[model samples]
Target: MSDHRSESSRPARVPEPADPPGTAGARTPEPVPAGVQMSKQSGTPGAAVPEPPKVPAYARQPHPRQPPSPWGPAGRQPSSDLMKIRPAAPGVIPAATLWSVLATALLGALLLGDGIGLNLFLVAVPAALAAYFAAQAAGRRLRPWTAVWAVGGLSLLAVPALRDAGWPVFLAVVSAVAVGSLALHGSRGWLGIFLGSLGLLTSVAGSLGWGAHGVRDRMADSRGRWGVAFRSTVAAVVLLIVFGALFASADAAFADVLGSLIPDVSLGEGPWRLFLGVIGLVGALAAAYTAAAPVRWDALTVPPGPARGRLEWALPLIVLNLLFAGFLAIQLTVLLGGYDKVMAETRLSYAQYAREGFWQLLWATVLTLLVIALALRWAPRGGARDRTLVRSVLGTLCLLTLVVVASALRRLDLYVDAYGLTRLRISVAAVELWLGVVLLLIMAAGVFGAKMLPRGVAVSAAVGVLAFGLASPDGLIAEQNVQRYRDDHSIDIQYLRGLSADAVPALDTLPEPLRSCALDEIQRTLRGSDAPWYATSWGEARARDILGDWDPGARVRNCQELGSGDQGNERGGDGTGGPGGDDSYDPYDPY
Candidate 1:
């Protein structure tokens, strides 16, 4: 009895952990089926069953938090990414990339360094650049395009060698800049590069000007500067050629501007006035197109083509430059009265004119800029702008065409003036018309489309024609006819080269028709070997064909047979006289 009582009072020995749900208890809990949970037991005999191992922090929980399988459960990937860490799929191409790259590559290649080479190189550069730019712009960003850039870059290395031979350094620099800028896709520091270039040019030009005392000396010293500047300006021009930016309405606006704003400048109701007026009218159209232009920095954008190279900024810049040049000429005329040409003494004639022209261009620039601002600030989200421009241009064209017809009908004697109804005049008018239409269309479409057509061609032709004509048969002819001693000397020398005999036959001296027969005879029998050694590059083949009947021996013998103190002896009576007499002629004595 004492022992039982003491045992009962003593604390029970430490109890064991409750068995896991399916495991046996001391009595062997009635074999619980698989699905059913085992009942809890008191610790005394079976304490309230220990809460199911209060979810162990590290241990895998039964629900949802299933352990990863050895079976490699992830689904398969695309074949492109077989590597350890898969790469991203190729990114979408930008819509403008093709156009930009094409323009950059072709223009760079074609106009590479702006005629750094000789005659062949001049034609080759622009063509090559155009093709390359076009190809890139269209599509096909092939390895070939990259190779073109490399070739252009490498060509720069040859500049030093070509320099003394008359190859330009500006082209080399431009080529190098283009390749490098394009290769990096404007990613690498382009700002640093442009600043460096500006520094180089201004510094070099200033240094040359300072070193040389006179304009003559300065020009000789800085031919390289001019060359470089020209190329760079051309490259800059390439940026301005925005595709498709003009119209008929714009032409009317420009006509109004020219007619009303112009000072006492008299175009005088001649064909020339109409021709030039038409061109101005076209410019107005282009201006209108510029007004509604999208935001694009032609100077900054690279990767070349017609759009990027020839169109984007090229046309507008040229117009600006020409205007500037004209204004300078006018100002100079006002001050100096006569001297306008850029001769050996007056090197900055164009620059001087350009300075004044800047004001006129400034007006246009401001007007266009305002339009652009309006576009940005409050452009309506519709086609209202397009419609308005279209109507304006169409109206202008109708008026211009009518005026042109009226002018043509009024002039009968002007036709005799040669230039009145010539192909050149017609071409100028056509160009104006086309430009006007383009400007109007561009106002509707914007800058991107404006440059795609014949804008540059039309404008250049119109201006060039005006220049040539203005300095032409009337004004230019008289100017040229004013022969000083030096001029007379040059003419006498040319005359001597073709003069057949010491005494041209009376008939040969006659102006035309009957004189041609005698002239032909002299050319055939005497000119090749006699008094005049007729070996001009021009007409050499034609002269040979026309004068082939003359006896070479007789011609040579007569040339040397003159009984005077100085006779132009041909052949020196060389025994080698045969057909055409050794394929050479005696030198013509001009003095």
Candidate 2:
């Protein structure tokens, strides 16, 4: 207390010695949080200021959000003018664009038609874009010279293709460009643009090659980027015309294939009309799907969702689609008035057909929709809603199951027709097959995908294509598609069971029926060869040496020679196993 009194009796406040540097007399605001109030003025004695605390590392420094204006007036505020008064063009697409497009479109042109070829050519667009994006990602621009080089490379490849006018060459060149661009710039955007232009060029080339381009003489057409658009229009028109001409010319071709089977007047005309009709329907279906669904075309994929164990969420959409497809098929037939009946006794046209089943389908659809509305209404809240979703979905599934079961119970024939997911139409079947495979792929791509199922499915599909009918043990039916493809003209499998010399040797080693078939194949194949594969000399040598003739001492009689049993090493009937110790792998034998 005495010390405090002594200090309080001090005369005046001591001032620190100045003159290290004279004060600038500038007022400094105390460091504070942004919105804190500051004192109005300093006291008579200079206000005491606390030493500023060290800033924490986690504190963020303020910065301008955007770049400074470029077109600012001097000493005045700059305007946010990223845009110039004018922009320049990239210049005329080089001649190489034509070559690239022609190259790309050649395959579809030869195999399908110019219309289909044009669609294939669009593949180049993404390829080009891929290269551009890649280069951009690597912190580089695709210079004009690079574009020139890429185009030039594509052009160089086309010289041979143009000379040959073959799709093989075209495919090679465009693919080269696409792949080369991806390799060089890593999927640049320019790759897409360049490829698109090239595809258009190719489409035009395809049209010309197919003898259709000259038909567009009425329009002013220039070849380049615009050439694609021009060619697309010309190709569409020409294809339509060409189809018309072919239909008129080949009455026999049309009548033999479709006239008796499909009685619709349009279908009776020719294959072309049928094809176009199918394509148009498919396109309409796709467009309608896009319109109805929230998903974009790019995202036309099945994504991972709630576990399949909780099937309630998934079944509704699935049933809806199935019913919709059925509804559409019936509705289309009715709307098109495609049905016609031939007289039973007279074998002549009887009555004009009106379509059936649309009204019933409509009523059922309305009922299903009402059920869905009711389900969504009283569902649980938040994530628990998923569980509540259980009821409606199960209900819908039960309803659908009942329908399928009821249809089954009504009549065996009707049940097969109703419940069979595979539609009768060729187009529908193809679509179904494609969708099935895609669905498999999607499931494979999921987190807890159908692993065991995918492997078996993939193997079976491969076996189907690889074995075809030729791989069958019976030799009468194909291992996979059997006679289905032959009747339908949908699949062609001439090259299945392509065994090498290292694999199964000659035909006779195989079990019967197959042995005869393989022998037949050998005979047919070796017919024209300088050194025939199944010639008597080669056959004998192959049978004697590679086939190992027979085991010790079972008298082997030959189909070719009776006493030649002495020439071929014979096998004894000591049937414990083979001479090599164990050759018996009988599929029928149980352990």
Candidate 3:
């Protein structure tokens, strides 16, 4: 029993692996799966140990620690969640851009002194060309549609060169330029067009920094040449001052020659020219930058409003249609069969009858447009049934509103026939006509999908403006009034005097004193110091040619006497201080 215990107490021998011949001193470790503990066996000798399941190589690597955030705990955000803010990348400005900007500056100094005219067209041309070339140099693909907008913009810019109408033409030109710039890369929605146009101010502001950077880089690259040019300019200026004074002191004839050669710029004029030059430079830079990196306004997405139930959507529109239909029936009755009867009942004259409800009808037409726009926004978009309902109800309302537009126009026509065509009357008539066109476009849009409706409306307005400018509103007003004067042997000498130079041709056809009274203001304007060739407009040039030989001073003295004596005999006068009398009449009043 002691021998058995001794044998059991003896330590069991474990097997040892032999190393290779050259690596005998170092023992190789046996491959073990990660995360599996290697515990020594205590039982039978030479028994094989079971292996643990293998772990993936990726799982075997330790996790990397994150770096500390510089912004602190609260300010720290996940990398994926952070929005990146980047400055506009500097681009290589084309040589054409620099030269064009210089040209624009010089032209602005020369032409903008008088007023806007052909000068605007002349200055804008180079800027536009530079933008086109810069866009090409920047490797941007010009959209085909953008060419149309550019053409339209240039055409509108030419309006001041052709017509002498004041604020209306200016507004049209401004709208065209802003919208055309936005469309350079093709905007998607009305919001995109509006916001992108507004952002142009910011673009112009940024151009200063961008242009300065570009100039600095260019100067750095051509430092030697730039220094030479700077020194040469300074030397020339100094030489001219020193030598010019000596020559002027020596000879009075030379001084006269020098005086004629150099323009006499006033202190205020110098700053004005400098301001205009800065405007030109900044405008060209903005155009270049915009063309190079146009905002992707088309990428902006506006989700539609949530759809409503068919009944919920169609009910109000149906009621609106019914209301429009009722108004239409009444308009038809009053306008067609009951005109004389209604006039008799109201105890109103022709002009009074036409002017009474004209404004209310125009407002109704405008408000109807707003209603249609809102209805389209919230209209049901479920299926075929909903689309049909929208088409039917909205279509009827549009048709009825068009009739209302016609009625408004008819009333204005009658008013013009009774009183005469003033700018106010013709302008409102044009607006009513445009609104009628808009309604027709909307009706067409309902038939075809409304996806392009916004753009369509913009295009229509542009077309309308172009047509109005081309037709020459002031000229048309003059022609119509002249025709009325001839037909009735009566005219408003005062009203024609307020017209621009565009009316000169029409007014020149009037007899003697009337012609002189109408052309006096325009002749005085043209007789002033002649504008530079670039600043002169076609209308002003023509006016000068027409009034060159005729003197208005002698005839204008008779205008007051003639106007006062004939005031009561005006066509629409009732001789009781009525619509036609000078005291009661206001040619400028829109309503």
lDDT of each: 0.32, 0.33, 0.73
* Poorly placed runs, candidate 3 (over 4 Å): 1-90, 224-268, 337-342, 564-571, 575-583, 586-591
Best by lDDT: 3
Q: Write the per-residue lDDT of candidate 3 for residues 1-591, one digit (tens) a residue.
A: 232333433335466666546766653344344346555556534334455445566666799445667676754645631122112453777767766776787777756776777778888888887778767887777676677678877888877888777855686777667766865546657666666665456567666676677678778899997788779988998999899989999999999877655444567788888888778877877877777667666555557678888899889888888888887787677667545755655666656667677889999999999998788788899899989988998899899999899989887876676667777777788889999999998998888876877677777778888888888888988898788777755567777888988999999998887888888888777777456555667887888788886677677886765554543223344442224533335443643
What TM-score number comes out for model 3? 0.78
* Stretches of candidate 1 exceeding 4 Å from the true structure: 1-161, 164-179, 184-381, 384-591
- TM-score of each model, paired residue for residue: 0.23, 0.22, 0.78
Candidate 1, 402-502: lDDT as tens digits: 33333332221121121112223333334343433433443433534434332233223333333332222221211221221122211111122232221
CA RMSD of all predictions: 28.5, 26.6, 10.7
Candidate achieving higher lDDT, 1 or 3:
3
TM-score order, best first, reads 3, 1, 2
